[model samples]
Target chain A: AQSVAQPEDQVNVAEGNPLTVKCTYSVSGNPYLFWYVQYPNRGLQFLLKYITGDNLVKGSYGFEAEFNKSQTSFHLKKPSALVSDSALYFCAVRAQPYTGGFKTIFGAGTRLFVKA
Target chain B: DVKVTQSSRYLVKRTGEKVFLECVQDMDHENMFWYRQDPGLGLRLIYFSYDVKMKEKGDIPEGYSVSREKKERFSLILESASTNQTSMYLCASSLRLALLSYNEQFFGPGTRLTVL
Candidate 1:
């Protein structure tokens, strides 16, 4: 019943310009959101997450995401894009059932291309 | 740091052959997961184990089975390798049920399996 969606199949950004990868979620109760990045021929690495507290979460590689409660969106952002930042980005959500424990759901992913 | 490692980086197998993919984690995580990754599908969970010898079916578990005999190792098995099963397989681990826990999962480099 819980799911996450990445709106873009691909995003092209010029170096030194801001970049964003949009994600939205549908879940029961409050949502636990996450961002992950995968380089070419590599596994995914955790970037950031938002469970409680601040809506603006800062993560590795100078990236950050804003969790919008009203819009049910968590978007990954960078002040300036870099060629190295070009990778596959996946948005995920954690589901905590009343019975305890948790499960994770991942989005289809967004391919980010940063042109230098 | 938590390190998750897969047994292989690349593998080639014939259709109908039994394929085994092994994974191990340095961290004594409570949860271990096997995921299948395709170009547009993102990460589809095949199976996950919350504890040693305890496994649960995930989103896509039709042709896959998993084993978690030890706390640090998890193995995924394809009963009959099909062309559709040819994809990247990723292993991951996470800390849960502990005093200090986050739903973040650490992933291995991944194994690219090609079933001909």
Candidate 2:
């Protein structure tokens, strides 16, 4: 079964410091990984996706993620954290099995708290 | 830019009432999804539609149903609303590809439904 795990329930980072949100996946075949952000009382917005391309994927709001094939990890990163960047982050995965069915899975989520 | 819109931002209903949540997307996406968001649980997929009149059960399909009679619109139905069903419902749409699809979903603002 394809599944995603966001080990951290919450992360606190200081402003101007680099931030990293961890994500790991388990899938039989190649994985299609994605990062999404959701603010308080708002819907989720797509951040970036890794589908068989360069490992480094840049997304909106100057965020980027690195897809580590061996480690089966796609971690979301930002050069510098901002107070406004504090939000809930989610990692998702989609894969096709040998039998030919598409399965998508989402992590429990990581709440990022950027401290000023 | 792709835009997904939900019919209501907030709703309150009594227990056992039949509830309907409507969603519309303007981008002409071939795929639409319904999810419920809760604290710590992240987003749980309830149902998805690959095309008009074609629906697939997601991870959490019990206690809810979906309708996609039109391409642009998708509706979620709760036969009898209960307190456990109170949640933030999200609607998302993405383009369906011929091959193994790996597309980022665009989400609506979301509807916060409260069941009493």
Candidate 3:
């Protein structure tokens, strides 16, 4: 079974400070990981994905994630946090389909609170 | 740009009522998925359709059914809406031919259902 774990229920950071939202995964073969962000009353927006190649993948809104093969982790990072950046973050891993296509398993989510 | 749209942003229903949540994607995606989001629980897949008339149970398919009569639309059915089933429902679609590594899902704005 492919699964993702987000250890933090909530993370607090100050504006302009670096922020990290941790994520780890367990999968059968190589993992395909993704990061999504959800704002108040809005649907989730794709942040970035780690499929192949570059360990460091840049994504939208000045966000980036580093894929650590040995650690089985893909942590979302930002060099400088903004109050607007505070939102619910989700980590997901794609699972191979049994009979048809692919399925994605998502983590419980991490709520980020950036203080101004 | 890919656009996924849900039929409603908010809905209220009584217990035991039959409820339908509809999703449509403008992109010609071969795979469509339905997931429920709860606070702290993130997103749990309820059902997925790989092609028209083809549907598969996801992680939490109990108490719910789905329909995919056309390639562009997928509908989730709740036979008897229960309080426990009250949550945000999200619909997503992805290209089937894309490699597993690059099969990124585009999500709808989501429907928040309240069963009282």
Instruction: Assess candidate 2 and give its TM-score to the true structure.
Output: 0.96
Query: Which candidate has the top score in TM-score?
Result: 3
Candidate 2: clashing pairs of residues = none
TM-score of each: 0.96, 0.96, 0.97
Q: What is the C-alpha lDDT profile of model 1 across B5-115, one tens digit per residue?
A: 999999999999999999999989989999999888889888888889988888799999999999999999999999999899999999886533457999999999999
Q: What is the C-alpha lDDT profile of model 3 across B17-85, one tens digit per residue?
A: 999999999989999999999988889999999899999998899999999999999999999999999
Local distance difference test values of all predictions, in order: 0.92, 0.91, 0.92
Ordered by DockQ, highest first, the candidates read: 3, 2, 1
lDDT of 2 at A24: 98
Query: Which candidate has the top score in lDDT?
Result: 3
Provide the global lDDT of candidate 1 against the true structure.
0.92
Residues A8-116 of candidate 1 have per-residue lDDT tens digits of: 9999999999999999999998788999999999899999999889999999999999999999999999999999999999999987642234578899999999999
Runs of candidate 1 exceeding 4 Å displacement: A98-101, B98-101
- The Cα RMSD of model 2 versus the native structure comes to 1.6
